[model samples]
Target: MKLTLTIWRQKGPDSKGKFVSYPMDNVNPEMSMLECLDVLNESLAERGEEPVAFEHDCREGICGSCGFMISGVAHGPQPATTVCQLTMRHFKDGEELVLEPWRSRAFPFVKDLVVDRRAFDRIIESGGYISVSTGNAPDGNAIPVGKEESDRAMDAAACIGCGACVAACPNGSAALFTGAKIAHLGILPQGQPERDRRAVRMVAQMHEEGFGSCTNIGECTGVCPKEIPLEVIARMNRDYLGGAWRERKNVVTTIAPVSDWDFAKK
Candidate 1:
């Protein structure tokens, strides 16, 4: 098989980047996407040219590190599959594939297919945690949790913090990501203590990081590798609203400007 790849190439964060084309032959359909790149890099090395830069780990799709825009989709044509799991057979014998990094103000390009996702870390640091002390492990059945509640919490917890949700959105929204984070903890009794403050701080950090607001277009859920449902966004909104009502007397601490507007319009 033969194919042409048009991939973005950037030397550094401040460098100007452009798409560079490469044509190759003898591609095997059974190879994973990263393996296909391995072949391409070997070819480039033979010609004394620099190879394309991309991110990957485990190559088994668990790390959520092998992320880049394939053709025009978040992780190629597959639904709920990461790029590392994407195989070459998805394409025809002779085809053209375009590759680029995740695009968002919060995720600046570091190189060809690598971007700075530290904004996500900052958002998590802001409030994506429970206040439980680090002590001895508790018994498994010490706290009673219904199956339905535990399942929902796990669904939200499935988010791998991949930026596909943001890349797929027309507004580059991080609501799905942020919402998943909030819903995971908000649904669990262990997270009750910081629930209100978590919503306020995390939402504020999300906006400050320059991620756009959700338009409810459903693109986030569509491309989510974890298949985290869009309903998580609704749950996030509900928790935020409930938190605000509980703290209505002390408006300054519980309400975030972005979330306040969203709640007011509702």
Candidate 2:
């Protein structure tokens, strides 16, 4: 199969980007998208031309390192599939695929099909883990978590932080990603001690990172490679509200004093 790839190209974060098209004459239907790119890169190297830049590691789709808009769809048109796992057979001969990087303020452009996702790392650092240290690894049956709770936690834990949720959202919201991180830990018994504080801090950090608010449009989950559920966002909101209310007194004390109290009498 033959295909044309119109890819976004930029030398650096501040450089001007443009679409550059490359026609492939020998595309194998069995080849994954990344593998096809590798073939293209080999050809480009042979001709002494610069190859297209994209992220990929462990092309099996577990790394979350490979992603970009393919023909305007995050991770191509396949549902719950990453770009590296998308086979060329999905497209027809003479088809043109347009590729672009994630376009969110929180995810600054790095180069062609690459963006800095460190903002996600910052949100995780805020309170995504249990700081308490257990002396040794416990037995599997020690915690005795309910089957339902464990299932939901595992569902939320599948989020790979690939930034596809933000890319697909019109509002550029990171709610889905943040919610998944919060829910996975919040549902677990090990996370019980810092549950309230974790929600408050992670949500606060998300806002500070310049991500948009969740309007419940549901775009985030629709394009998620892992199909992370929309309920995670609701869970995040519930926890944040509960935590904020509990921390209200401490929150108020941190605010600066009001100097014009007498004006109310007028």
Candidate 3:
């Protein structure tokens, strides 16, 4: 198959970007999207032209490092699959494909289709860790977790932090990604001690990162490669509200006078 590609190219974060067109011919329909890019890079190198810079670690979609918008759709037209997993067969001959980086204030363009997603890392660092020791590996049976709980945890943990959710959201919200992290730990017994605090801190960090609020448009779930359900956002909302209530109660208690405290104590 043959197609035309209009790829965004930027020398650096401060450089102006523009779409440069290239004609791709003799592309194998069976080739993965990354393979097609490899072919393009080779041709560009052969012509002494600079090649397009894109991110791809595993090239198997496990790493979530390979991500870009194809024809305005995150990770191409396929559902629940990353760009590296996307194949040329999904496109028709002579089609023009437009490739660009994930656009959002939080995700600044680094070069071409690569964007700096360190904001996500910061958000995770805010409260994504468990306060458990790692001195030695514990026995699996020691936790006594139920199978259903384990399955739910695995489902939430499937999030690969690809930033597609933010890209697809019209408001550029990272609610899905944040919610997945919160849900994954919230379902586990070890996460109980910090559950409310985790929710509050993560949400605060998400807002501080300049990510937009969720409006329930559902685009995040629609373009997620992992197919993380929109319900995760709902769960996150519940946790956030509960967290807020606890915070407010704590504040009131801290501010209460001795007489009020004694009356309440009675």
Candidate 4:
């Protein structure tokens, strides 16, 4: 199918950006979105034109590297499908698709369709791991973990850190991402030692990264390619509250909520 792609192009972080349109003919309906991009790049290269820069790794959607705004929606219109897994068949012939980078203060644009997601790594570094004796991998059934708890942990652990949560959120909040990381470890026995501390440290680092607070708009979960539930944010808030209650002296908390029509609402 033939399609028109309007892609955002920027030279560097400080450079200005604009949408450049290209008529994409000869696109196979079976080709994944990233594959379509590859075709475009090949055409550009043949013509000695600078190709668009986008992120992709393990194009199977396992890696969260491939993500950007597609037609004003994260990962396109499909639910729980990353851009790499999206196929050209989802679009109709002559359709115009707009692609842009994930917009957030924490995710500054590096180039065309690429944004620096290092802030997520910093949050994980703050406290997304557990302390354990270093050695060979332990047996799976060594610890008697309940099936329910394991399921919850697995659910939270599915987060790919794609930053779609931040991009979809009207407030540009990273609460969903941070919450997923916290819940992934907090629900497990091995993560007990740093459970409360993990919540505190990670939340602190998230704030430091300049990400906005969660407004409970639910847009984060709406765009999450992993389909991470909104309950993860609630879980994170609960953990943060518990941590603050326990370490009242150290948990410097300041919460200022935003409402679109609070003061003027009838």
lDDT of all predictions: 0.84, 0.87, 0.86, 0.89
lDDT for each residue of candidate 4 in 1-266, tens digit (9 for 90 to 100): 88999999988776779999999879999999999999999999999998999999999988899999999999999899999999989899999999999998777668899888888988898889999898999997888889999999999999999999999998889999999999999999999888888898889889977899899989999989999998999999999999967875685433332222223222
Q: Kindly indicate the candidate among 1 and 4 with the higher lDDT.
A: 4
- What residue runs in model 4 are displaced by over 4 Å at the alpha carbon? 136-139, 248-266
Error of 4 at 95 (Å): 0.5
RMSD of each: 6.1, 8.1, 10.0, 6.8
Off by over 4 Å in 1: 248-266
2 against 3, candidate with superior lDDT: 2
Tell how far residue 123 is off in model 4, in angstroms. 0.4
Error of 3 at 9 (Å): 1.2
lDDT by residue (177-252, candidate 1, tens digit) is 8999999999988988889878877877887788898889898888888999989898878877777667545433
Question: For model 2, how does the per-residue alpha-carbon lDDT over 160-257 read when each residue is reduced to its tens digit?
Answer: 99999999998889999999999999998988888888888888888877889899989888889999999999999999999988864533111111
Cα lDDT of model 3 by residue, 1-266, tens digit: 99999999888766678999999879999999889999999999999988899999998778889899999999999998899999999999999999999998877667888887877887788788799887888887887888898888889889999999999999999999999999989888988888887788888888877899999989999999998888888878988889977874432111111121122224
Give the range of the ten consecutive residues with the poorest summed lDDT in model 3: 252-261
